[model samples]
Each structure stands twice: as C-alpha cells, then as structure tokens.
Target: MEWFILFIVGVVGGVIGSLMGLGGGVIVVPALLYLSAYGLIGDISPQLAVGTSLLAVIATGLSSTLAYYKKGNVDIKSGLLFFIGSGPGGVFGSWLNGFLDAETFTLYFGIFIILVSLLLFLQNRLTPVDLPKDNRVMMTYVDAKGIEHQYGYHLPIAVIISFVVGCTSGLFGIGGGALMVPAMLLLFRFPPHIAVATSMFMILLSSTTSSLTHLYLGNIEWILALLLVPGAWFGAKMGAAINTRLKPVTVVLLLRIFLLIFGLRLIIDGLL
Candidate 1:
C-alpha cells in the first residue's frame, strides 16, 4: 500500500513537475510526511523524506533530460558549465544536512519557496523589452525540429545560480528547477519551453550528483526511490508531449498555480 501511494504521488508530481520544470520534491515531500505519520514507512523521519525525495528527483531528471534531449532542447555547453559548480555544491549541501535540524531545513525551504514565487510573479508581469538579456557568454543548439537557437551572455550568473540551487537540492532533496527555469528565462532570456527543457538537463546532472552523495550519507531510501521512478518516467513523457501543444502563457499560469499551492502547503506544514 505504501509503495502504491508513492507510485501515485510520483506520477502526479512528475507530470506537474515536468510541465513546470520542478523537481517534484514539493509533491514527494508531502506524500512522505503523510505516510510517515501513518507509520506506512516504519520510523521514517522528515530528513529521510527529504533525502528520498531528492533521490526520486534524480530519476525524474534523468528521464526528463532524455526526453528533452531527444526533442533537441538541451544546451549542452551551458548545462555542462553549470554542472561544474553545482556538482560539488550538491555534495557540500548533503554533508551539511547531516548537521541540521528539521526546523532549520524547513525555514530555509520556506524562504526559498516564497522568493521563487515572488520572482516568477514579477517576471510574468514584465514586458520582454523591459527585461534586458545579458550577452556575456553564449551557447547555441539545434532543436529536434531543426531550429537553431543561440543563447548568449550571463554565463557567469547561470553558473552562480546553479551552484546555489544545487546546494539547496542537496540539502533539501529538491531539484532546484524552480530557480533554474526562472534563471534561464529571466537571466538568459530563454523562451519558456526552452527554459524548462534546459532546466531539466541541468537538474539531471545536479540532482544525480547530490543524490549519490546523499545515498552515501545514509539519507536515501532506495526501495522508495525505485518505486517512484516508473511513475515519474511515464508522467515525464506525457508532459513532454503536452509541452508541444500548450501556449506559453497557459503553461506559465499552470506552473504558477502549482508552485503557489506547493508553497502554501509547505508553509502550513512549517507553521504547524
């Protein structure tokens, strides 16, 4: 029954997360919390919940990255550059998690969630012309459809942000896609679809590194993570298919709503 519950959560989380470029931790964490409270997973703690969620994010990232890559949305150069910093930061964050309390972790997560929410809201309101693109570091890619796109400038910023987000993911068991997608869109001026696809590529590397580190630190639940992967895989493929048919505004609004709900749920969980 517990595994069944996890499978369902994983599918739903993956679908929503793939659509919005999230790590699915927002959904996974809550599911873990409920199951643990009911003794569904014996003696499971919040830390385990976070760690397991991170591990699941690793799977989701791998699946989504492959799908996006097939569709020609990944920016390999930029993704590799960001991973250089994020990979190490993830290890560091996992190490630090061993010393932190649940309240401390929750507080940090709450603050980040709120900040991400606000940033997305504000960005949506801004006109494209009002948002200036940084052209410092550039990368080019050809999509599956044979469309060529170039992204230039803000390479340094992308690296810096990826490191920060990776650290958080390592610590909190998230994929940091919330921040990554926005960074790609707002900082690098990527189209929403491209931003999401690229974010998946970046998160795959970052989350895998972090998950492996966390697993070594005794934070991962392999059984649970394995159970979730199948559902996540199915959902990701479905979501990727949907991405091609949806309007940008519609996708953004849907993502915003999901984030808001997740943020609110987390906030309530923290307060209680």
Candidate 2:
C-alpha cells in the first residue's frame, strides 16, 4: 500500500517536473516528507527519502531531456559547457550531504525554494513582454535552426553557477532545474523555452552523478524511483509541448505561486 502511494506520488511529481522543468524536487521532496510523516509512505528514513528523491531526479531529467529533444529546443553547445562543471559538482554536493542532519537539509531546501519563487515573481513583474537587454552574465550561440541566440554570462560563468547549483542539488536531493532554467533565461539571456530545454539537458548530467553517488552510498530507494520515472517521462513530454504556447510571465507567476505555497509549508513545518 505504501509502495502504491509512493508510485502515485512519483507520477504526479514527474508530470509537474517535466512541464515546469523544475526537476521534481519542488514537488517530490515536500510530498514525500509530508506523506512519510503521516505514515503513508511506510517505514522510510528522512535520509532515505532524500536519497530516493535524488535518484528519481535522474529519471525525471532523462525524461525531460528526451521530451525537449523531440521539440528541437535543447541547445547542445551551451548544455555541454554547463554539464562539464555540474557533473562533478553533484558528487561534491553529495559528499557534503553526509555532514548535515536531515533537519538542516530540509530547512535550507525550504529557504532556497522560497528564494527562487520570489526571484521568478520579480522577473515577471519587472520585465516587460519585450524587455530590453540584460547583460549580467550573457552567452551566445547559434541554434540548429540558424537562429543566433544571445545569452547572458559566458561559458565559464555558467560552469561556475553549475557547480553551485550541483552542490545544492546533491545536498538537498533536488534536480536543480528550477535554478538552472531561470539562470539560463534571466542571467544567460536564453529564451524561456530554450532555457527549459537546456536546463533539462544539464540536469541529466548532475542528476546522474548525484544518483550514482547516492546509490553507491545506499541512499537511494530503487523501488520508489522506478515508480516515479514513467509518470515523469509522460509529464516531461506534456511540458515540452506546452512550453512555446505558455507566456513567460504567466509561467513565472504560476511557478511563483507554487514556490510561495511550498515555501510557506516548509517554514511552518520548520517552526512546528
């Protein structure tokens, strides 16, 4: 029964993760924790939950990547550059996780989620439909379709950001796409759809390393992760299909609402 519920959770998480390029942690972590506390997820340790979530992200990333690939939205050149740094960063973050307690991880995760949500909200509110140039950390490349895309931040800066994002993902059992997508769009100047695709591709690298490290350390719960993957794959496809149609401002607003709700939940949980 517990297994069945976890599987259902995975499906729902996967669908959301794929659609939003959030990498599933935003949904999976809180849901798992809440369910576990209620004894709805069976006998699962908090560390196990974290580990399982990381492993599940690997599947989510792959599913999202494949979905984005089908849409021709992924930017391989930039994604390769970002992946180089993030791949190892995942291992480093996972190693660091060994040093922290479950509460510490949860608290930090909650805070980070809240912060991202706020950033998304601000970006939506401040940036007009036809926003001007923002050269904070830009990069540029030509896509397969002959579109010469310009992004913020050079390759080196993106690598540096990837390292930090990877560490957070490893430490907190997240996919880090939530951070990566925004960074790509707002900081790197990639379009939102392109950013989502690229972020998914990069997450494949980080999540793979993180999952492997966790699995080797006996952190992952295979049964749960497996259950989550199928649903996530379908969700990713759905998300990719909708990416172009959805307005960036609307997406940000919705994502912000999700973040606010999740953030408040975490804060309340931490306080209680």
The numbered model that scores best in TM-score is 1
Task: Please count the clashing residue pairs in each candidate, in the order shown.
Answer: 3, 10
Give the TM-scores of the predictions, in the order they appear: 0.86, 0.86
Best by lDDT: 1
Residue pairs that clash (backbone atoms under 3 angstroms), model 2: 137-152, 137-153, 138-151, 138-152, 138-153, 139-151, 139-152, 151-188, 152-188, 152-189
Report every candidate's CA lDDT.
Answer: 0.74, 0.73
Q: For candidate 1, list the clashing residue pairs, or say none.
A: 135-153, 136-153, 137-153
Off by over 4 Å in 1: 127-135, 141-149, 248-255
Candidate 2 local lDDT, 1-272, one digit each (tens): 76666666676666666666777766777777788778776666556776788766777778778878876778877788887788888888888877766566667667888987887666644442223344344456576668887755566677898988787778777788877776776666777677877887887788888878888888876777777666666666666666656654565577679788888777667656
Instruction: Count backbone overlaps in model 1.
Output: 3
